[model samples]
Target chain A: MSLPTLLEVVNLKKTFVRRSGSFLKPKKTDVYAVNNVSFSIEKGEILGIIGESGCGKTTTVRMIMRLMNESNGKILFNGQNLCGLSDEKTTKVRKDMQMIFQDPYDTLNPGMRIVDILMEPLHAHKPNMTKEEKYQKVKETTEAIELIPAEDFLNRFPHQLSGGQRQRIAIARAVILEPSFIAADEPTSMLDVSVRAGILNLLLDLREKMGLTMLFITHDLSTASYMCDRIAVMYQGSIVEIGETQKIIDFPTHPYTKALVSVVKDLNSFIENRETMILDGEVDSTKKTLGCAFVSRCPHQEAVCHNVVPSLEQIDKVQSVACHCFGSSKMGISERSGALV
Target chain B: MGKTVLSVENLSTFYKTDKGISRAVENVSFTVEEGEILGLIGESGCGKSTVAQSILRLIEYPGKVVKGKVFLHEKELISASEADLYDIRWSEISVIPQSAMNALNPVHRIGEQIMEAILIHEHVSKKEALDRTKVLLELVGIDRERWKSYPHEFSGGMKQRVAIAMALACYPKMIISDESTTGLDVLTQSQVIALLKDLQRKMNLSIILISHDLPMVTSISDKIAIMYAGKLVEWASTDDILHDARHPYSRALLDATPDLINRDKKIVSIPGTVPNLVNIKSCCRFHTRCPFAFERCKVEEPELKEVKPGHFAACFLEEENHELTYTS
Candidate 1:
């Protein structure tokens, strides 16, 4: 039997209306930061949202975390719609949902001690606990994150710890409340190559130990492949493809996903002759296109791609792609429009 | 092999802080031949940037190049006069620093920034410099018409290309790119690296590419230098370092990086953090993290020596020649 869905995002969208021109005649244009994004995470499974900067991967998660209000859609957490929830009810729900930011240096409070920093979450969520009980929980959580000799670390500040250690403390604080769901946003990108593996491993171990569901967001495809069981490829605020990690890496159906996978620099690929699909232009999120978002940079673009947006269609049992080349009657449309371009 | 354009010998740079001296770079040495790209790689705070700044004599107060000699075309740079160094800086050696894309002045046009470098070093008319700036922009694959655009008008990758164009404005023989592509996305980074390689081939220019990214450095560089805690642990050809690395730290670093082609490979992170460098003990700085470290590593410092011809490694395990077991 399949695991029950823990967090589901349906028809989520975020649009930012920009104002320009003179004070007398201000021009307004809508920028679709996130356009009709939908995905669901299975219990105890890790889902990764992979995309470059300004692709709305972070924005989607931010809206889920209630850090930013979504323009439209439904966020169902444990079968409850989070969008219509009261502020007090949302606070209670936030106890089960935690976020780990990218930069450990800035996320942590430099002025506070490690004990106080970790205790902040407990204080908010469990206000009735005694000081001794809170202190004991803090020590246990500190040691749980592998910061051994908890006494030594509990008294220190964030600045005293290394980048890896600081990140561990951040993780400890997030998991202290026993959050069933966590969203890690490029957690290891700011770290060194050697330390990155440790954090990734720790997260993996934590997921197994606590039965936690994770939303791993990253710009690096390799990291996504390593940490995630299922991957979602985002382009211009939309998931162009979603599939199993190995399937996405080996057989990417969408052109944007293919381009992303081709550019990953690996050790073996360095010496071998590999075919690289180099896209022409950067991601233009400002331009509101009526057709497909990737039509401008895609090499296999046809006349149909410029007129109609392709909806996500299942190509295989485990994979789904949003591209005209992989839609219904895929070959027929491509063959007919092949002569025009 | 071409003529040696830059050589650094016994280079040691230190920062004098209130809590003793911090050995930022210790006895690091390497040579760059004409048109050759040497990849200097290490973790953050490992002194890769310090080595670059020392080579360029850009280290300021509190940080001093305590010992060493830097030779640019057989001319000693350590003791060179200020006037001579000024004339040699951009004209002979230029730098594309980390976050160079953001280094572009927001108010000025991209064309004016490229021409400013040329105008300062050489006595040329504004019109002539502008013409050369447009040509340089074209060389870096930017449209000549977009030269007049402000920094905000260009994308991140385009701004980096403009930075490269500015670095090439004076036709420097050697360039130092210190983590210049760190902030760019994977596709844009590959494109920038490809552009750098294309420019290196076309101009026959020597480059010192410094970054912590191993795969990217190995993909483009001819030689690789692996630094750890302000010390050069291994230095060899890209092939030798990739296939036959002797130092435990270098081998462990290779294993630590996540491999894209081989998804099944397990990433092995080193056990400990980089040791403190301030008034450090005379021993292997990587001993805390190196799995093969023995008693000798704690008591005595290993000098970077030639284990094989043209390959240098600072590990005692090279002498023992143990059977190879760890494989990625």
Candidate 2:
């Protein structure tokens, strides 16, 4: 039998209460942000959750971390049902599952020094540690992230540091207890374009050194391929495609995935145009429509596309795709599931 | 052939502070050919924005144009009086700055704002200016009927288009877009870029597009200049710069950008942050982070030399005389 999964999600869903219409009666509208989403993370595996800003990538991670309660479905972490946990147990679980947020400047507290910011996680979960022990641990963790010369940085505040430094502190804080899993949500977007590569390499190095499992969230497919072993492409709160990173990139099955894969500007190619399948329209976070969210902009859309929501099917031996038309994989060595029954 | 619309020579801008003068741009010289799209590219603090502002004489005091000359249609702009500068500002050269969301007046209708700009630069009657304003809106792909709508009613991309239309009210010969598509997503970016390209071709307008996106710049611009710590490190045709970039920094930038063709290839981002531009350094600005740094790079800064036909780079490794500088 296969080894047990570290994180297993089943039929997960989230709906928010909206300020209802006129004096007839106030009604609660369901947003369906994360609608019937289900996935799992294997032991020490970097599973990439790729999607646009409003595709519910963040919400899925938030639900897994127990930051927000799921409207429905089960969330199992480390073979334990996290959704059914008491408030106290959930708090304990948070110590083991940390997240590295997008904006480095906004995440760290401006009022606190680097030392205090790094020590906050430890003080919160393990309050029994002595003050001297806390200081030593902070030094060790900061050094582990290659932040360099711990004493010089300890006295400096977050504002005094650069974007790269602040992010290092964010990483150091997250791994202080050495969390089993990290949910890095667009960690390098706010940084300078040139400095981004080093950050990615650091993450790569740390993963190998610590054997840390990560749930990498990013809109960039190339970055996902670089960092993750497997990836799940999210679209309008549902995973449209999931497979091995190389298999997915080489042979993307879903229309959305193909569009994303095609849009990237490669320095390696000399061809004038590589089928520019530009995805139309801005990603509106407030969309509460039924059926497929991308239907309004999808090019191959038929009349039925507007009426019926597509479901994920086993498209090939290794990959799963959620689309109505699963044709042959012209992209590379793979085959798409045939037309719907 | 389109006429040479704008020319800038030995342009140096500095930000004066208590610590020292931050030499943002040093001895930068480039000419924008008429109807040609030139991209000024670099990471943050590279002085790309400063170069744009200096050319426009929009660099407010404390951050002054310490050296160099700028010319509009070959007419000197460096020593041009404030009044003369005003005449050239929108009537000849226009700029689409980043903060259009807050730059436009909230109380005023979009049509009135365009008309006001027209009235200030050119002597036109109220009705005449209003008609022209609507046409200008239509030219930028916005509907004439929506001219009466407020800026808030429009989306981010539409607001930017309105800003572009407003800048073009006087039909300026040159336009500078400072990171206009910086924050927008890929789809919106390409659309805006396409619109700008269309406008450039139709109006024969000389456009200076400044941004940090290498692929986007290389895809659109006829020529590009890579800047670092306010120093221009590389200049070449778009084809040469992106495909066969000789400069270390340019290659690093290309390497850092995610490879769309080869998804398997990892992006090894350039190590180290951009050096702080507190005071001007004699050595090459990018040497601290440049992987190909040598002893000479650390001691003396190299001038931008012609390495290939129609290309220039401030690198010590490339041959000094390659006979390709004047193709620009």
Best by lDDT: 1
Give the whole-model CA lDDT for all candidates, comma-separated: 0.88, 0.81
Q: List the residue pairs that clash in candidate 2.
A: A197-B269, B24-B230
Question: Model 1, range B131-207, lDDT digits (tens) per residue?
Answer: 99999999988888888999988888888888888888899999999899988977777777877888898899999
Measured against the true two-chain complex, the DockQ scores of the candidates, in the order shown, are 0.55, 0.41
Candidate 2 lDDT, B144-252, residue by residue in tens: 9888999888777778888899889999989999998777655556667777878888898889999987767777799998888888888888888878787888888
In CAPRI terms, model 2 is classed as: acceptable
Off by over 4 Å in 1: A127-130, A265-276, A327-341, B320-328
- Model 1 lDDT tens row, A1-341: 19999999999999999998899999998899999999999999999999889999999999999988999999999999999778999999999999999999999999999999999999999999999999999999989888899999999999999999999999998999999999999999889989899999999999999999999999988888889999999989999999999878777778777767756734233222222344558677888888999987776778889999899988878889898876445434453232211
A155-191 in candidate 2: lDDT tens per residue?
Answer: 8989999898899889998899888888899998788
What's every prediction's RMSD, in angstroms?
3.4, 4.8
Q: Each candidate's interface RMSD, rounded to one decimal?
A: 2.8, 3.9
Model 2 misplacement above 4 A: A1-4, A18-32, A127-136, A266-287, A325-341, B1-3, B123-140, B264-266, B319-328
Q: Where does model 1 sit among the CAPRI classes?
A: medium
Measured by TM-score, the strongest candidate is 1
